[model samples]
Structure formats: structure tokens, C-alpha cells
Target: MKGETEGRFHTPDVSSITPGPRRATLRTADGVRIEAVHDPCAKGPADTAIVVAHGFTGAATKPAVRRAAGVFAQYAAVITFSFRGHGKSGGRSTVGDREVLDLAAAVEWARSLGYERVVTVGFSMGGSVVLRHAATHRGSGRGRTEAVAAVSAPARWYYRGTPAMRRVHWLVTRRTGRLVSRLGFATRIHTKDWDPVPLSPVEAVPLIAPTPLLIVHGDRDPYFPVDHPLMLAAAGPAQLWLEEGMGHAENAAGDALLGRIGDWLIAARPAA
Candidate 1:
């Protein structure tokens, strides 16, 4: 991921490169046309490929997501795209349930580009999607994902008294999770059912053993609390970093977090 400059956001000039900015309309398994942004840098054949997923209401062009893409460009080809209903992507937010397919579509896009090593980074809601993807992809024979990194993600939903998260279940489910069952994918806030695969990153961590995993969270994050990462780290070959005084989605400029991620990637290189 790219670093921040002077505590400000910097957008990558993907058009200046050889292949330039490759724009494509990706159709998810559910037939949603997701607008994807692909930056093919001048760097030689990429040794690794990274696909990034943003948090709720975030788009591919978001400053943090773009910064992450920029940071990864130094060592790997990077791809970022909006989950349906955000930015130019189509459809509505599934609250990280069906969004896993959207993530899969993005990963497939990177694989089609001939990237040998693949890594995925997800923020908040996007983090859950990547964790689910890793669990389901193992031994499926689709392809090998080298590693996964999650930032400010929640291992379990429905936690009581979380400061970072608003009571979205009311808005998401509308009528005590009953409307979701009857209405199905027509709920107002969430267009899909509420069955989120029942798998949390803490439980899924051991499944990803032998494959490096990194979990980063803010010390003051109100949403999931620092215990989420701590529990996750105890599950498998995982490393946890708690940024002091950082809140959920802290806009710490200067690529401070991205640098940590880059260092982890180098140290956690997958086996050959």
C-alpha cells in the first residue's frame, strides 16, 4: 500500500504508465456490474498481486484504499474496486454477506492478469469478506492466495456496547431480523439475507495456518475493540498490532500503517 504525504491523500497517476489505467466492467456471480480500477505500473513482472476491499460506504477511489494500493505497487500489482452500491459499482450493500462474491470476482480478475502470488487486504466490513474467502478457498483448487491482512475488522457481529459501531441491525434488519427472513434480499439497508456464514476470523484463523495472516486494529477503536485482534492472533499463525491512540479508520497521513503492512508482507513471504 502507498504512504501518505505530509498527512494528505495522494492519488496514483495510473494513466502515465505503459498499460495505463485499465478499466473493466466486472460482473459478479450474481450479475452485478462492478466497476474495477486496475493500475498496471511500469514495474517489471509483478512478484505479487494485491486486491483491496474498502469499508462500508467506501469506494475504490477512497483516500485510504488508494493509499494502500499505491503502497503495494512498489512490491506488487494492485487492484481496488468498490463493492456493489458504492462508488461506480452496481447493486446494494449486503453487509459483507454476499459481498464475498464481489471480492471473489476481484480476485479472479487479478488471477486472470497472470499474478502468481496474491494477497488481499480488507478494511472493516471488507475484512470479514476476505476472511470468509480464505476459509472457503483453501483446498478448493481455484488458486492459491498467499496471505490476507485485515484492518479494524470485526470477528463477530451483535456484540453489546461497541462504541465504533452504530446499532445497524435495526437499520439492516428493520424489524428484529424477522423482516429479513420474509423479505429476503429486499431489505432496505441490506439487500440480502442475514446469514453471514457463521464463521468469524478468530475461528477461521487456524484454518489459514501455514498461510501468513496479519491483523491490525486501533487501540481506541470503538467498533470492535482491541480484544478482537487479540483473540484472532491466538487462533493461528497471526500477528497483531494495536496502534496507540488510533481510532477506527484514523486518517493517519504519511503511510504509517501501510509501511507496517509492507514490512509484514516482506517478513511473511509465502513458502515456495
Candidate 2:
């Protein structure tokens, strides 16, 4: 939250056990310039690359974001990017709708860097983008995603809002939206678009089956109920990590969670 600016978010600098390679300015298909940090340790061409997308109001340099990147870097090249309007990246956030494009761009960027296999990890709204991208790839026969992992992702966008969320939404939309709009920030990014069909993780899971997925959520997460990951697991070859006391992005940084994710990725690697 401290890194959140008027438009973008910034993450803290992470210390790595081994210094990883660095790069900047990976351009996407839509012409938006995405700023990415690449960390490849002990590598010529990496065996795998893990690309991370942060949650709503999160940037590439957040503590959790850095931890996730570090976890993957232990075994593979890791590329972390801030979504449009959420970091040094260009363009506004289209919620998760057009953010799918951002994911695609990130994947392409990773592949271009000589990573033969690529896995995607996303948190919250970032998780939604991962599902959408996997679905889109499966539909187009582009190629299968090696693996996908999500943390605290909501199943639906406009679910029955909790009393707390309702109050928070009211307050933010009323007070914050007004201030953001007056200050020239596009507050409409938070507004939902009307679609007869839902675009959340629940609806997207059925399409991701056979493609390995790991869904981790806190049992006590107030924003997205624990049942969301349960529903997703029911639909795919997905494993659920329900931490008893963790909430929201709680697993985003933990060594235990990252170790589990690393093991999952190693086992789920695509066949050569």
C-alpha cells in the first residue's frame, strides 16, 4: 500500500542469494511498454521462466511480489511486471478484461528471452489474468501453459459483496472516486462492465483442466471466500492451499508457500 501512487505501484528491492540478470522495457503487442525485471541465475537459456503479475493496487516491487519472484528464481528465470496503470508500465488498468493482453505480452517477452518453458503466477486480480490467458491459449491452440498458480483470487467480480466490502466500496467509490476523478485519475477503472456471462475464475477453470494449476487462498480472506478455490479445484487438475489463519495475500511472501509452489512447478513441467 505504501508503494501505491496516483497511477502506478512500486515494489521494494529484494535481496537475492544469487545475483540474477536484469533487463528493462519489454514492449507488448498493444504497443504498451511494460517494465520488467528479469532474474536468471546460473543459466544460459533457462529451463523455465516464471512470470508474476501482482494483485489489484500491487506493483512489481512489493514485498510479497519480490518474495514470489525470489522463490521462482531459485529454480528458473523469473520475470515480474506491473500491470498497466499499476507500476512503471504504460496504459490504464482495464480491470482483468484487457489485462489478459498484458499477460500475453509478458509471456511473449519471456519466451523471447530464451526460456523454453514458461509458467505464470498471479495474485488476486492478477490471478484472473492468468486464468484468462491460459483459457485463451488453450482455445487458440497456441500451446499449453506449463503451469499456473494463483493466490487469493476471487471467483466472480461482482459477487454478493460482504458487509465490509460493501461499506468499503461505498466509501471508496463515493469519497475516493470523487477525489481521484477530480485529480484526473480515471476512477472508472474500478467500475465493472456489463457482461451477460461472468468472467471470473470459476467460469474460467473448466477451460484450464489438464493444464496444472495451484490455487492458494486464505481461509479467512474477507475479499474472496475460501470456497472460491474449492470451486476452482473441482473443475481442474488444481490443488488448493487453504491456510488456516492467513488472509488475502498472506501466502504471497511465505517461504513455505513459495517452496510448495516451486515443487509444484518442478513436477508440472511440460514434457520435452
Candidate 1: tens digits of C-alpha lDDT, residues 91-127: 7777787777788878877776666667787888887
Judge candidate 1 against the unseen true structure and give its global Cα lDDT, from 0 to 1.
0.69
Regions of model 2 farther than 4 Å from truth: 1-19, 42-45, 139-144, 167-175, 178-198, 250-253, 269-272
The 0-to-1 C-alpha lDDT of every candidate, in the order given, reads 0.69, 0.68
**Which digits, one per residue and each the tens of the lDDT, describe model 2 over residues 1-272?**
01111122122343333255554565555677677777773344456888887877666776778877777777777878878766677776666777777777777666655567778888888888888788777632323467898888777775556674564355344656545642453223435444544367777887786677888888888777877888877876677888787777624347777767776875784334
TM-score of each: 0.80, 0.79
